[model samples]
Target: MKNILTLSLVTLSLTACVNRDNQYDYIETPQPNQVADLQDDDTDGVINARDLCVATPDESEINNEGCGIIITSSNERHLHILFSNDSADIQPIFSSQIRQMVEFLELYPETSIEIQGYASKVGNEEYNLALSKRRAEAVDRRIESMGIAADRVTVVGYGETHLEYDGDDEMSHARNRKVTASVVGYQGDIKKEWTIFSRLPK
Candidate 1:
């Protein structure tokens, strides 16, 4: 009788273990953010393979992948400001763009920017290169004055290398006298740029 009792207990323990295993299998699993569902075609969870924004930025609506594409609108695209013939003084019109970029950078923990300068084909290669470098430095100084860290900017002057126009005329030269600002590094919660996040059923 004792042997039978022991056997019965063992059987019950085995059954309990199996039940626990089954329960674990049914437990709800955590899902990634912003993935879309193709089976249901309308469900949203994490940004998945079919997600349209393949280059989906990793950030909130405001913090895109260092690209600053989230806070900026496609219709009103931000362009680099052009400098005067030999100066880096930013025109008043570029103030709004500067403000926008500054605001965006402030949200990240660490951020860096690159300023590149180009010159027209009018001057000799060496002269144009030197001029471009000065223009780039001028713009970098202006941005640094606005509270961004000086060490974070990689100032470089290509000197007419990235010219937008080919000729030495005013129109072509005008295109070459420009400074471009590019964000290089930033740290923060910047993930899931494209996806329906609200429709999840929990």
Candidate 2:
């Protein structure tokens, strides 16, 4: 009878140990909440993408698929430097404007510009084309001379094309003969006002 009782007690202890091990084997570890971790709270069709400007105001103008807006208030990014007849030289009066542009490019190292040169309808198409190219190159050289990298500037000659004013007047021809500098590949939010170019003192 004593041996039987001792054996029964041993069997009960072993069964308890087995039950404890089984319980531990079936236990589950905590997992991360994937739904809670998801971004894009505003749901403006833009994800948590860092390349674009996010969380823009509802009333603000957005373009380029919510990246930024076209700044039209100031011509800081787009400048028109008028030229004399049959001349590719940048006048001294426009030096202040070019300097301001140079300063802006210096501030934003990643920004690049396109210098588009134009000519009046007074000359032949081929001659005007070459003249416009020279004008573009002149502006490009000026920008490069101001310590800006040559690679950042692109020269384009659009002779007698996209005329700002179309008329048989001197003012129209003068307006057509110009070089426009436009900033490209700017990856920043469009502000209300850009840096204005200060005119040089007379």
Instruction: Give per-residue CA lDDT, model 1, range 9-63, as digits (tens).
Output: 9988867746644652356679868554434222233333344444434443422
**Model 2, residue 142: C-alpha shift (Å):** 0.8
Q: Put down candidate 2 lDDT per residue, 50-109, tens digits, no spaces.
A: 326667654455554555464533234666899999999989998888888898888678
TM-score of each: 0.51, 0.55
Give each model's whole-structure lDDT.
0.65, 0.77
Cα-lDDT of candidate 1: 0.65
In candidate 2, which residue ranges exceed 4 Å CA deviation? Answer: 1-76, 184-202
Q: For model 2, what is the error of residue 198's alpha carbon versus the real structure, in angstroms, after optimal superposition?
A: 32
By summed lDDT, the worst window of 10 consecutive residues in model 2 runs over 186-195
After superposing candidate 1 on the true structure, give the runs of residues whose Cα lies further than 4 Å from its correct spot: 1-79, 184-202
**Could you tell me which 10 consecutive residues in candidate 1 have the lowest summed lDDT?**
68-77
